[model samples]
Structure formats: C-alpha cells, structure tokens
Target: MKRTSSLAIRTASAALTALLALSATACGGSGAPKSRSGGPVWAEGQGATEAVGFMRVQTPAGAAEMKGAVQHGFQDTTYLLSFAASTGDAEAFVADLRPEEALRANIPRDSTTYTTITPWSHLGLPEPETQQKVRTASVCPPCIKDERRSAVQSITIFVQDIGDGRARVYLKAF
Candidate 1:
C-alpha cells in the first residue's frame, strides 16, 4: 500500500544521508576541520591594544611599542605579542609569569641572539637586526621534556636586553 511505500522511502533517504556523512568523514572531511575558522588571520599594531586584545596583561611601565599577530593554520592557531620596556619592567614581567617549569627545562638557559622570528613566526615584527642579551621562558600545560607541544593553550616568552636600560619582551601563545 501507499503507507508501506512511504515508510520505505523515508528509511532509504535516512540511510543515504548517513552513508554520505560517513563517506565524507572517512575521506578526510570536506576540506578543513570543523573546529576552526575557514581561513588564517594576521594583524599588528604600534601599541598594546592589539596585543592586549589577544592576551590578558597590563601594559608595563615605559612600554615603548607593542605588536600582536596571529596565524590560523588548517588545524592550529599561533599568537605572537611583543613589547619594549625598561629593564626593570622586563625583569618584573618575567617574574610575574607563573609556572616557569617548561622554560626552565628547555635547553640553552639564555642567549644573546634575537629569537628567530620570520613572517611565519611573528607576522613580521621589526626586531633589532643585532643581538644583545635574551632571556627565554615558556608555558604549555601538555609539554614534556625534550618535546614541546600544546594542549588547550601554550605560551613562550622572550625578554631581550636591547641595552640602554631597556628590554624587549616577546610572547608567543597558541
């Protein structure tokens, strides 16, 4: 009867929809992951607005400049922020950070070279072309010794003594 045909058609349509969904998933998705945005975003500013918008922190005393940029990959997002302040401010900034274990465990206690950041690293912050002195630290709840990884969140800190009683702080979070 018409009732049985209608029931059969409804069942067939449901099964077809389920099959198509499974097939799409098994084939590595339509294109991009569903959990993230469809495209990458990048931006930079001369002061703390952009950086602070992405992070939670007070502008340090004598903050000369700050920049924040983000790169959203197919499955991951990276945020970069930097600021220039007095040496005392830099030290305080480093001390104010919590859970420095990941940085402590990282090798090369310190360095005199600028942390290598390219367009891919910082979306192009104008770092001084020369090295002075740099102190580094990082935070990643899921990171382990010899292997750096991110879980829900991650942060990497770099404080460079650009001399003249000023230090530049760079932060990377994802």
Candidate 2:
C-alpha cells in the first residue's frame, strides 16, 4: 500500500511540472516583450523627413535643425518634435492643425494641463511670456481632418513666432 501511494505522488509531481512549463510557453513568458517595455528617449538633429514621419505636418523646405523625443509606455507611444521655420511659414504650417489653433507662446503650454505632456524644456525651446500680439497655430487629429490623419489618433501642434523671422514648432503625436 505504501509503495503504491509513493508512486502516485511522484506521478502527480511530474504532471504538475509539465503543466507549468507549458503554461509559461503559451503565455510567452512572464514579462512584456522588449518592444512594448521600452522607456522614453530623446534624439536631436532630426531632419525634415524623419520629423514629418512622426507628426502630421510638412515642415518647410528650409526647416532648420530639429529635435525629437519619444516616450514608449506599455500601451502607447508619445512623440515630441521641435524645429524652427521662417515666420512666414508659421501660418501655413498651422493651417491643417486646427483643434487647438491660434495658441499664443506667452501661455507656456508646458505648464498647462490641457497641453501635451511633453515639455518645451526637453526640446530646448523656450516658452516666451509675451501677450497674444503674435498668433500661434495649434491643430490636431480628427478635430480637424486631413490626409495625414491616417496613422495617428491624437496630435497637438504649436507654431510660435519668437520674433526675428524665426518661428518655433513644437509638436506631439501618438
């Protein structure tokens, strides 16, 4: 009787081990894949082509040196991009980005709760504390439709004229 009981216990233990191994394999291990678990990162000197790939706007042909950052959460990716264009291009640049259209640089979007979580400090772009003398254009997806709306569900853009014919572009999309 004792021998029979010991054999049954060993068989049960073997069966349990096999079950656990199979379970792990089917669940793809105990952790999230590397792609989904990546952390936030910043990249500088992004060209017009690369910057446009991440956002909905087409920077001017003469857009200057650009900066970009990406924060990858487990479920979504937040993209931040900054560049400078001639003040003349600011109007057309914000033409399509209308949801938050006409935002002023004086407000400092980074300090606001309604604006993007990505900060201007990260992009090395300063937020001037001037009044609404110069209009800033802000736009987004679905709020204002466009062909560029295909890839992303959310976007917010701000083009501020910082004087001297230079306008700064701050963009966030996911």
Candidate 3:
C-alpha cells in the first residue's frame, strides 16, 4: 500500500507539472506569427517604433499633382497624413528624398527634429515585401520638457504604389 501511494503521488505531481507548463504557454508564451522564411511578420498596425519629424522626400519636378489629408486616430493620439500621388512620380518622389532632410515642411516650428534617417526595418519591422513598391523612413524628435503632457515624438513614413497610376503616402506620427 505504501509503494502504491508513493507512485500515485508521483503520477499526480507529474500531471500537475505538465498542466502548468501548458497553461503558461497558452497564456503568454507564443508570440507573433512568423513568415515562411522564419522571420516575424509585420502585420497591419502592429509594428511601429517611435519617430518625431517626417522624412524629407522631395516631390519630382513636374510630376503628377498630389493631394494630402491629415487623419487623427479614434483610439489613440496618433496622427497620419495621407497623400495621393500620380503613379508615375511616386517612385521618383521617394527616391529623391534625402535620408536626413529637415522636416520643417511638416512639423511645427518649435518641435525638435532629428537629422538622422533610419529605415523602418531597422526598428524590428519587416520590410513591406508584399507591396508593389515601398519606401519607409523614421526620425525621433527631441523630448518635450513639460511634465503634464505626454508627447509622442516618433514619426514614420511609408510610400507605396497602389497601381493604376496611383500611389499612397502615409506619414504616421505618435
């Protein structure tokens, strides 16, 4: 009887250990989905790092006209500036942008702007390989001194071709 009780206790302990392990994995161990190449996939609105000033991409001279609008997020303090451009000029506009151009054209006069231009992929975001053509850049502005306000100083820009003589430009700032 003593040996049987000991074996039963051991079996129960083993089952409990297995249950705990499975529970932990089900709760938080699994992470974001991975691509076929074993790289993490950057899902829509999932991977964004902080940036401040907009990337400086020059519009090609005499390219098709462009229109823009600013959109505010409903659930967050994020802001996005969307631009629609002629497909012919979209690639050239993105290519002509200097990596470290000042963002005076988009940011407020008093806002601090960084001179460094970093690729979005460097911030743990996967390249937009699925898009027809895409370019992304980011800048982090200087931090605000006020204690009462929470300022998001990171900005990222994406320029992507959407086909049919149209390209979309997205500037996401948080």
Candidate 4:
C-alpha cells in the first residue's frame, strides 16, 4: 500500500508538471497577426538585406511627358523606381524601412505636407513578389507643403531586377 501510494503521487506530480509546462508555453507563443494603422505591416520574414538599388526620382529630360494630375489638392506625378534582391532577401529590405514612430518623429517642422503610400501597378507588370522575392511593399504620394505651390517631390517606385543576390530601387519623380 505504501509503495502504491508513492507511485500514484509521483504520477500525479509528473502529470501536473507537464500540464503547467504546456500551458506556459502556449501562453508565451506568438500566434496573432500584426498590423499598423493604414500602412503596410511587415511579417517576421519580410524584405531582404542585400542593399537593392536606392530609390530616386527620374530626370525631367528623360520623362516622356509632364507627368502628374490633380489629386487631394496637389498635382502629383508618377515616378519610376526599381529594386532587385535574391529570392531570400525580401525580409531584410522591409525591415530597413523607417518605422511609424521614426517617421512621425522625423517629420520636418516646416514640411507640413502629408503623403499617402500605396502600391503602384500598371498594365503588363506582374504584381510584387512579396511572399517570394520582394517580401514587402508600400506606396507614398508626393504632396506640396502649400496648396498654392506646385509639387515639390515625385512619387513612384519601379522594381526591375531580383537576381545575383542583389536588388535595384529606381524612382521616377517630377
């Protein structure tokens, strides 16, 4: 009887230990989706780190025409940009972007202009390979500091390559 009781107690204690461990692990695990206001939210493994080309504006001389139309009180022109990265570098690219807090803190005191970011797409172009190559993406519209002034910046990104463990980021700004 003594031996049996001891064995029963040991068994129960072991079961309780296992249950506690499992509960703790489950409570500490990550299982929920992440999101940010209206901006794009990056997952754990979005974008690459291989330094795709930088984002910049296209020269006016190169433009086929004077691009831009009135939108939200400003004449915004579409810019062309490009990026290239290895199939696995997408996560790093997205991580390198400025976070929401950083952007808010960096807003220029005199630069009261607001910009909206959205993905740009046109006919014949395939969607960004966020899940496979690009990892993450977003868009930002160029706005003027004052309604009376013309646009002071361009807004457009063009992805052109994703090979040789590198990437390119081109911008077409007017």
Candidate 5:
C-alpha cells in the first residue's frame, strides 16, 4: 500500500508539471513578441496626418500659444507641440481635430495591436496637474512603413485645464 501511494503521488506530480508546461505554451509563454517596427504596438495604424494638418490650420492661435509653451531645445523635434489657452477653447480645439481613421480611445498595452489610441499615462509618463479636467489622445498611424507618411509616427496629446478658462496642451511622440 505504501509503494502504491508513493507511485500515485509521483504520477500526480508529473501530471501537474505537464499541465503547467502546457498552460504556459498555450498562453504564449512570457514576454511580448519581438516587433520589427520597434515602435509601440499602438503605433501601427493610419497616422495623424489629417489631424495635424487640421490643427495647423484651425489652431493658428494655439500655434502662437505654443511658441511660448514649447521648451527651447525641443522645438526642433518632430511631432512635438505645446500650447496654452482657455479651457473651453482648448477642449473645442481637440474636439474639432479628428483622425482620418477611428482611434481606440483607451490606454494600450504591449499586446495592443495596430490602429489604436492609448492614454498618455500608459506611456509611463508623469501626468500634469489640472484644475478642471484633462484630456488625451493617442495615435499610431497605419502607414508606418510608407515612405510618404506624413502623420506623426506615434503621438500622444494631453490637454489640461489650469483654471479660469486657461489650459495647457502638450504633445509627445514615440
């Protein structure tokens, strides 16, 4: 009886080991798959080309505001912008700007596929303080490999109301 019980225990242990191995394999193991683009998974969709153009045209006032808000050294950086304005005006500006394709309106993860917009916080960046509200948008352009890609590659924009109709806008690209 003792020998039989020992054998049963070993058999159960082996079964458990096998089950764990199988589960890991079925779950794709650990770590994300290597990406060729090296950009975030969210960076794989139609970019913000039209949106940027629209911002440039519609928010000339915001652009002027950006002149003061942009850090001096970072001004030459591509796909980065900052501005300050009234909260209502800033919200309206963001609302008016639309991406050519539908953007996912949530934070994305490593497993996130192409064609989605994750929140700014997902990038592990510090969130700015706001008195009233904060808004953000993420875009991963679809034509990442296209030569004529005009949109911001992988960008996130944050708009926050500082109070008294004043707001701050910040854009970052990955």
Candidate 6:
C-alpha cells in the first residue's frame, strides 16, 4: 500500500509540473490573429531584415499573478526573457530580468534541432555582466520607484541568418 501511494504521489507531481509548464507558456499574453504562416506581425525595423525568427512576451502587472508571453513562429532558434522583481515594496515592481535565464530559456532542449541564443550585443550599450548589475539599475530601493518598479512586459526578437548574412525576424515574449 505504501508503494502504491508513492507511485500515485509521483504521478501527481509530474502532472502538476506539466500543467505549470503549459500555464507559463500561456502567461505572456494572448495569441495574435493567425496568418497563412500563423505568425505574429513582422513589418520592418532595426536589423529585422537580418533576422530569421523572433518571439514576443507581455507579462501581467500584479502580485504573484502569472503574466502573459507569446511565441510567434518556429524557426531554428528560440529565446526567453526572465522578469523578476528586484527592489522594495513599490520600487521593486518594474519588470526586471535575469539575462542568464533569458540565455538558457532561449532554446528548448528536448528538440533535435540546434537553437542559438545570443545577447543583443549590437544594442551599442554596455551590458551588465551580472544579473545583479542589470537588476540594480532600475530596481534600486528608491530611484524611479514607480517607473523603475519591475512590473514590466518585454518582447524579445530573434532572427535566423540566411545564406546572405541577412536574418529573418522571429518574435518571442515573456
């Protein structure tokens, strides 16, 4: 009877994990209207022409409530953005992120294809080496409390390079 109960508990835990994963994927936001390719809108901007794919995410604004994020199309690449609250009561609310999480979450591991997650090195600004550095700026205790508050929504853009060194833009969000 003990063994049977253990099996049931394990099964229940697995089910719960699967449910949470599914729920997280849906947390970013609602899906946009479908196109023939069934992807998000990609007009034109930045180095988008150099992109191969992308993802967009929009998180909810509140307490522990889950936020919304979305993935537009499937490409050889995947990306993820992690938003965390870094500061105090009011100030800690701006949507802050752990870039490392973004890097790891960018690609899905179970798939057979190769997916790459690169930092936006081209943004031309010095990036913080540690997640703390990134989190520190906007999440400081009292600075820009309202504006810096981590309650945020972000859109991460992915692009796959074609033969000509140009990429197709893919959108992902969190």
Q: Where does candidate 3 clash, by residue pair? A: 50-154, 51-153, 51-154, 51-155, 52-139, 52-153, 52-154, 52-155
Off by over 4 Å in 3: 1-12, 15-77, 85-130, 143-150, 160-168
Sequence-dependent TM-score of model 3: 0.32
User: How does candidate 5 score on lDDT?
Assistant: 0.49
Q: Clashing pairs in model 1?
A: none
User: Which regions of candidate 2 fall more than 4 Å away from where they truly are?
Assistant: 1-49, 104-106, 109-117, 127-138
* Per-residue alpha-carbon lDDT of candidate 2 for residues 1-174, written as tens digits (9 for 90 to 100): 999999999999999999987787666776333343345544454434454686756767777867777665546767777777887776666665665545644454333543434455665655422223334444546665656666676766656666798887767777
Per-residue CA lDDT of candidate 6, range 59-110, in tens?
Answer: 3243221112223335422233322221231132223322212222133233
Candidates by TM-score, descending order: 2, 1, 5, 3, 4, 6
lDDT of 3 at 111: 17
Which candidate ranks first by TM-score, i.e. highest? 2
- Candidate 6: where are CA atoms >4 Å away? 1-152
Q: Estimate each model's TM-score.
A: 0.53, 0.56, 0.32, 0.24, 0.37, 0.19
lDDT of 3: 0.46
Count residue pairs with overlapping backbones in model 5: 6
Best by lDDT: 2
Q: Write the residue-wise lDDT of candidate 1 on 14-40 in tens digits.
A: 999999888878766893445644555
Candidate 2 lDDT for residue 105: 48
lDDT of 3 by residue, 1-174 (tens): 999999999999999998987877766666334334423322344321211122223445554323322223433345444455786665555444332443223321221332222223233332232343665665554342322223545555576666787766655555
The TM-score, computed over Cα atoms with residue i paired to residue i, of candidate 4 is 0.24
